[model samples]
Target: MQGENTSVERGIFIVLEGTDRSGKTLQSHNIYEYLTAKGRKCVKINFPDRSTSLGKTLDGYLKKSIKLAPEVSHLLFTANRWELHDYIKTNLQNGVDVVCDRYSFSGIAYSSGAIKLDFEWCKSREEGLISPDVVIFLDVNLGLSSGRSGFGGEIYENIQDQSNVYKAYQKFTNYSFWHSVNASQDPNVSL
Candidate 1:
């Protein structure tokens, strides 16, 4: 036991982000299942949780039933993640790896891409949060994604908006923690 540290290993934070219908939810679950099958503790979570009051507001906004300024809506999305910061941290500290379907990346990409918000400003709002260990950017063809079920149900589901968001997501591709995947392929394809 001489050089073996007796410390517990902290769990990693993995985020799956992409345009709507790009299989983020599916991939997140897949990662969680893979980890669990390997006997590692894992859990899946998603952004715009839609369970809290703020999330309710966000849900309304997404559904087009409530209107908010571009900046306000972006901040609301950030706040939804902020509200869950402690929970995520506690779980990681307890050795439960987290697979988040969408996180701050989606917020910044959507607001800046679709509404022309300042990318830096949108990114700054996410400062000080638990950074993801890796961000799996699901790069899929928007044309292909558009054909998926429930593709046009939300406000940003249109081609033009998704196109913008897709471009915005490209900005992060250069980051060291970012990983791009060809999501246009079958979901069963290994990542």
Candidate 2:
């Protein structure tokens, strides 16, 4: 019998994480477009995708049309990512670099910032998810971030919540393979 070929191609998982209005979406798109223009096969995805069922739920919660418990909303956000987990893994295995805007880190940071749950508890829910190879965090002060366009519509879009989330992100810096970019300045200079 011939041996089966089971080698898996290792692909990079790049994640952009930050508070609302931190330019994560813009930077992620820029990187994605740059890589694609360079002829690299890449996949760009965003959390709270809003197309999936879980994401729709999160959208309702964010829009204040629905009132979910903090924990429930957090799980919904995590579930939104879970819905796309396989797609991400498959793309990576196919040698496509997966670039994500607002991923697991956001799930943990946003949830932990809002609720009193311990960091370990928030992390436990995401134990089996594929970890990102490189996490580029855009660090912007709450005041500046709030002043940006489209702030304070969602439940966690306030300066206080953002400040708490910033602290949580700071604690997350202890993890290996995480990079922090000071986004208080211009994106052209920061990235």
Candidate 3:
């Protein structure tokens, strides 16, 4: 009878995506805390994670003091995620839900918008990567987004690129699994 008692828990992969200043970080943390309060095993992760070497490079590029080719910067962003691949898989296998601030979607949208690359071309770099079970995109107008605090530090932190990235996200919204939340509205109502 002991041998017959077997059960497995399925983990949920949730990704939060948005242009800079759209409050992706705040929402990701809010969800993580909410899940923890409910006693669910959960972990929060962010792309371009500054703790990793690749992420450090990304940080440098974002600050604009160090200039990298658009293609190279894009690759670095993708590599940062690749570095976390094993950890993500192991945690999910152990039945811990993973909440990510950004992922392949940000990689594709940001790079494509910056380099004028075709969506497929930018997406190819993330081929074979683990896809999220649920993708929540926070939508905000570029003008309002730029007016938000701390919007000026990053190299790609601008109204124009944010606009282009927002459009790129629209193309991806055709997928039934993708959910878009109006981030411009009140946070209590948006979630």
Candidate 4:
């Protein structure tokens, strides 16, 4: 017993990406539940983790309660992710699978897609972060999304901005670990 290895295997990092009303939050929860039901240790985390200071600022910007330049907002978003980098890594290393509602991809997508920032520049900020073992992009039709509830509640929820963001997400689809699913289906259906 003294020589037995006690270290547990690192957990998988899973991220869900998509436009507004694309059901990322719902699916992230579903995935977490599925893993837990299967007896896997899992934790679900959402980006811009609004409880944090940086996230609070990002929240104000999102809610139109405050204003920030495109570049400044972009930096803040990246910083928000950085704020939780250690937490994410620690959990993964402890063998707790992470199911994220959103991650850095949304940073690149929203900044570049909605604000016309350089795609490469937006992506550069995410270079040193923990990479996801799998990224699920919930693809939803913009028109269909418009009819969904709470479609325009936030700054980037508008059709034009979402269309741009969708386009940006397309650029990353070719990544081998990225998977796109049709989110237009009824919620009763399993992903």
Compose the digit string of candidate 4's lDDT tens values, residues 1-191: 89999999999999999999888888999999999999999999998799999999989999999999999999999999999999899999999999998899999999999999999999997899999999999998899888888878789989999999999999998899999999999745668
* Consecutive 10-residue window with the lowest summed lDDT within model 1: 182-191
1 or 2, which is superior by TM-score?
1
| RMSD to truth, every model | 2.0, 2.5, 1.5, 1.0
1 versus 2: better lDDT goes to: 1
Q: Estimate each model's TM-score.
A: 0.95, 0.92, 0.94, 0.97
Worst 10 residues of 2 by lDDT: 182-191
Note the residue pairs that clash in candidate 1.
none
Candidate 4, pairs of clashing residues: none
Q: What value does the lDDT take at residue 86 in candidate 4?
A: 96
lDDT tens digits by residue: candidate 3, 66-152: 788878887888888999998898888888999999999998998888567778877999987788899999998778888888998
Judging by lDDT against the true structure, name the best candidate.
1
Question: Tens digits of per-residue lDDT for model 2 on 97-185?
Answer: 99899998898888888665678788888888999999999988778889888898988888878888888888878879799988998
Pairs of colliding residues, candidate 3 = none
Clashes of each: 0, 0, 0, 0
- How well is each residue in 10-52 modelled by candidate 1, as lDDT tens digits? 8989999999999988888889989999999988899989999
In model 1, how large is the Cα lDDT of residue 138? 92
Off by over 4 Å in 2: 1-8, 188-190
- In candidate 4, stretches whose alpha carbon ends up further than 4 angstroms from where it belongs are none
